[model samples]
Target: MGLLHRFANPGRFLRLAARLQPWTNALALVLTGWGLIWGLFFAPADWQQGDAVRIMYVHVPAAWLASAGYVALAVCSVLSLVWRHPLADLAAAEIGPVGAAVTAVCLASGSLWGKPMWGAWWVWDARLTSVLVLFFLYVGHIALLRAFDEPQRGYRAGAILALVGAIDLPIIKFSVQWWNTLHQPDSITLTGAPTMSTSMLWPLLISALGFSFGFAAIVLARLRAAVMEQRLRVLLLSRGNAAAGAPS
Candidate 1:
């Protein structure tokens, strides 16, 4: 709580994020570029799917970000609702568009992968449907954040929507198990060893890490810009008021 409040100060966050941004950007580029090259050109092809399995490297990371990004947004929502921190609100606002884009990537890659393996571009499989719902939830959160005339009201409303929409995350994770879906059960699990061979697993892991770092880099950059913009607005408003109060 003490730590949260300390970083919740916009100036403090800006300083910290500024220091972290360049490093994150560099790491994201190096790692993602390396992972994509390794996955696409060097990783052993799946016996079953052949080169088509390469898409997993992209799809898996986007899927991970789609859910993980929403979890971050929900945490921001909690901070806003419980503490009414404007920084939390700003963070949540920045997360929405990025989250939505990642989710779209997840959906598009999944569709492309499916068309090759499943003979169709899309299926109403349980996991696929749940992920689609997650995308819509992101869209709704973004919409609510801008719907109100007052920014505070918008933040509060968006926060509530984010909290409620969090129910979809669990559903997305378990959808394949709960229903007889076209999607397969998870290849990787916390309790069980990965079903995928290490040759493939290593590249996938690297790709996911790269995407995670990239996502963090983007959100931090946007949050810093938002804080600066808010400060500029406040400065301008104060100047306007001061001018009005002074003699002509």
Candidate 2:
């Protein structure tokens, strides 16, 4: 808890987030834009899919961040529940919608990719179904946070949902192998070199990094705003109580 204690102060974190947000946003925009351009033009087209294969650049990274964002939310949920860290609640609240938005993007892009490749805009393939469930989990997390009247009550409920929803992440990862699916097997694997050529892989990696930085920027900005809002609420309530108690 020592490491956690150091970062417990909301004011300190807001200051740090102010310093970091611009840089992360800039990095995200530049890298993601360049990657898209490179992937669409310079990277060699897939022999099988030709120009349509470029959709992988966006779809893959959005899918990666959707899951990664959920993992972060789950970790924050645990911290909020176990340690009662104020910042942890703020993190879960801020990150939930971002995860949901990215998950939507992932699904939309996957559908776009599927139309030409599979001749269907939607399918019940194991991998696709798992990802769809992941999207719903994100939505549930967001909804749960907003469902309660008291802020802390909402946060606690959302945190529990986040943890339970974490079971979906592993399912999403292994669904391709656990059952037959139309989605291709992993092109990049842990035990062996990536099957893709360097030309195609490079842009995808760049786009992933870009999206990651963008996600960081958005999360930080949101966290800073949430901290400030809570701070303002505290000040207003304190003032109201003082005025009410004074010589009435």
Off by over 4 Å in 2: none
Please count the clashing residue pairs in each candidate, in the order shown: 0, 0
Where model 1 places Cα greater than 4 Å from the true spot, the runs are none
Candidate 2 residue-wise lDDT, 136-175, digit = tens: 8888878888888887898899889889989988888988
Q: How much lDDT does each candidate structure score?
A: 0.94, 0.90
Find the 10 residues in a row with the least total lDDT in model 1: 1-10
Please write out the lDDT profile of model 1 over residues 1-248, one tens digit for every residue: 88888887778888899899999999899889888899999999999999999999999999999999999999999999998776899999999999999999999999999999999999998899999999999999999988989988999999999999999999999988898998889999999999999999988999998999999999989888999999999999999999999998
lDDT, model 1: 0.94
